[model samples]
Target: MANITAADVNKLRQVTGAGMMDCKKALVEAEGDFDKAIEILRKKGQKVAANRADRDSAEGAVIAAVNADKTSGVIISLNCETDFVAKNESFVKLATDLATLALNYETKDDFLAASFNGLTVADKLTEQTGVIGEKIEIGSYEKLDGPFVGAYIHAGNRIATLVSLSANVDGAEEAAKNVAMQAAAMAPLALNEEGVDSAVVEKEIEIAKDQLRQEGKPEAMLDNIAKGKLGRFFKDNTLVNQDYIKDSKLSVSEYVKSVDSNLTVTGFRRVALA
Candidate 1:
């Protein structure tokens, strides 16, 4: 067996950002061969990654980036095991870098496969997990494109929203940003009643009817009452039909019309760390 020196272990730790004991063990297991020691550390990282694969990583930041023209944007959620690690500067920086990468990569798989410095993002994440002593992952990712795309990151970076508009007008970008904020706050399920899942609509209607029946409402009035209740649900849960949070007097659709009559929300994406 080759002798493993303290100097060799320290050097390996510096190069790999792995724990001291981990570096020492790798050096001992590699027979003090430097290159083999590095490989051992990488494999150790992979092992850690595999061990923590099932761990919940709900604490992290939602980040976003937009193009110069404000016509394209990307949003991403970087998840960690604890809030302390989530607030770490290094973790937040990694989230920002990933959000930037999401601008070019359309899917989470692509973002994970993206290159970071000298290694792929997945490998880098594995290395980070070993160093940070926790599980970490990309919880969600999305790219949006339209005539006007606005991105918003809510308090503590916990929620991210992207709003895409159908028209590019004088105030379209500003309106879209407000809509993004609305999404972050209201958690709308879809763009409008048309976008909501039909099954969900039916379920909501049935729930409404059941509640009315429990109240001893006449069966003859069930359909009309349930339809009214369904309308209320859509107005509360759909993006355009929702009352504008900033100006409750106007619906979101009305707010957009006030901004630019031709401008409308084409689509939106929202992601939260939880």
Candidate 2:
């Protein structure tokens, strides 16, 4: 048997982020061959991932990254099975690194295929599933690009948002981040009434009409009342129409306009841990 020294086990541990004993066992299984030991560890990860395929990875980190020019941004949620693993420093760092790398790819599939320290992002997540003993995966991925874009990550890494503006002007950073925070806190469904889906609008209108009928309103009046209620729904649920959380007197649209008359929130994306 080839001698599996302590240094060899430690090196494998560093390279694979596996438990010390697991690294030692893998090295012994590979007869102290580093490359073969790494392959064994990867196969172990693949096996663990397969075993945990049905598990729910509902808790983890929500992270966002924007390019230096602030014209584009991406937000991603790296999900795991438990809050205990989500709170680990190394786990948060991994999420942060993934978010940073995600800025280079426009789609989740592309990001998963991108290289990370010689491993694809998807492979890394599978590998981490074995190291952490939990199902690990990316739960959400959103990208935005415009004249200006900014990101905000809520405390504890539970929520993240990206906001895009109509123009990149002075104070755009502050404006964009403030709007992004509003998005994180309010969880707006869309940027404006025009952005709302037709199905959602129909559903809200029907719900409003049903509520009016429950209140004993006449059937003929239901259409007008429901239309008004739908307008209120848009104001409450749409990003630009919602009242600003910081200064409720002004709408989000008004607040952005205060920064610059030409400035407007063009788009936004939000993701939260489930």
Candidate 3:
């Protein structure tokens, strides 16, 4: 058998993110053929990654990445079968690497078409599917971008949110991320009162008026009832009006009062399992 050098093992480790022993073993198994050794370990990991896919991936991760200047961010939900696999070193590595790839692609089709290692992202997932024998999937991919952005991945990587701000400020990105975290938990519709659709408001008033009339409320009271109901609508749909999950004493709008008034939520995206 041809002697495998330490240099060869290190090279494989750097390329594959596998352990020292695994690299050495792969080199030996491939008879000191570096290229073959790389494939050997990759195929093995791919199998393990794929086999883990079929298991309920409810416990997998939410990964996010931002451009160098924090002008753009990508958030992704990568699911595996169980918390065990979710915490697996290989699984986490794959998820982060995939997130990096996702940052460059705008859509799912584009992401799948992109290359990962020697295989297209889609093919890698397919190969992993075959190996893990579980249902592995890219649950969601979201891109939030503008002049400035921030991202937050909640515990267990189950929830991910990205926010874009209109004006730059100290800790502005982090504050926007808090808002995103609020959106993930509260699921708001509009960033503020003005952002809410007037049509939706009108429709909501109509519904409230109808319900009031059905309840035998006097017509005079119907208008007041409709107005009163509108408050609930705003509270439920508008981010500024919604209760801040972090601190219920203040609405999300109230929380942002200390920040620059111009720092509006230009856009945001929240992702979680269906």
Candidate 4:
């Protein structure tokens, strides 16, 4: 058997971010062969990932990143099994780095296939699963781009949002960010009434009719009353029509118009830890 030194164990730990004991065990198992030790550690990660495949990864950080031009942005969540692992500085940094990398890709599958530190992002998540002993994975990936884009990450890293504006007008940054904040806080279902799902609209109308019938309203009035209720639903659930969180006296559309009458929210994406 080859002798394993503390230096060998520390080197493996540095390379793999594995715990000292894990690195030492891996080194010993590989009989002091550094390359073999790394392979062993990776196999351990794969095994751990398989074992935890069914575990819930509900806790971690939500992060957002925009390109230098601010015309595109991505929001992602790096999820783990517990809040303890979620709160680690390194874990949060990993999430932030992933979000930055994600800006180059349009979809989660492409981002996972992209390389990071000589490993694919998916492989990195598997490796982290072994190192952290949790089901580490990317829970969400959302991307948006337009004439101007802005992003917001709420405190505790639990929520993140991205907003796109119709034009990169003056004060566009502040307006976009405020809209992004509104998205993170209000959780709008769609950008506008037209963007809402048709099935959802029908369901709301049916629900409104039911509620009005329960209130003893006449059957002939159901259609008109339901139409009014549907309008209220749009005002409450759609992004542009919803009341601005910063200034409830102004609707989100009115507030953005206040910024620039020609500027409007083009798109938005929101993701939260789940």
The backbone clash count of each candidate, in order, is 0, 0, 16, 0
TM-score of each: 0.87, 0.97, 0.73, 0.96
RMSD (Å) of each candidate, 1 decimal: 2.9, 1.2, 4.7, 1.2
Deviation from native of the Cα of residue 228 in model 2, angstroms = 1.4
Candidate No. with top lDDT:
2
Candidate 1 accuracy as TM-score: 0.87
- Sorting all predicted structures by lDDT, with the top scorer first, yields 2, 4, 1, 3
Better of 1 and 2 by lDDT: 2
Worst 10 residues of 3 by lDDT: 126-135
| Candidate 2, residue 234: lDDT | 97
Evaluated at residue 128, the lDDT of candidate 4 is 89
**Between prediction 1 and prediction 4, which has the larger lDDT?**
4
The residue ranges of model 2 lying beyond 4 angstroms of the native Cα positions read none
Residues 1-274 of candidate 3: C-alpha lDDT, one tens digit per residue: 9798999889988776667888899999999988898778767767766556446656577888887888888988777666777777777788889998888888988998999988888767765554445556777888888878888777767778888887678768678888888888887777776887889888999999999989999998898889999999899888778887888887876776667666666777877755
Candidate order by decreasing TM-score: 2, 4, 1, 3
Compute the lDDT of residue 22 as modeled in candidate 4.
94
lDDT of 4 by residue, 24-96 (tens): 9998888888988888888899999999999999899999999999999998999999999999999999999
Q: Candidate 2's residue-wise lDDT over 140-191, tens digit each?
A: 9999999999999999999999999999999999999999999999999999
Q: What's the lDDT for all of these models?
A: 0.88, 0.94, 0.79, 0.93
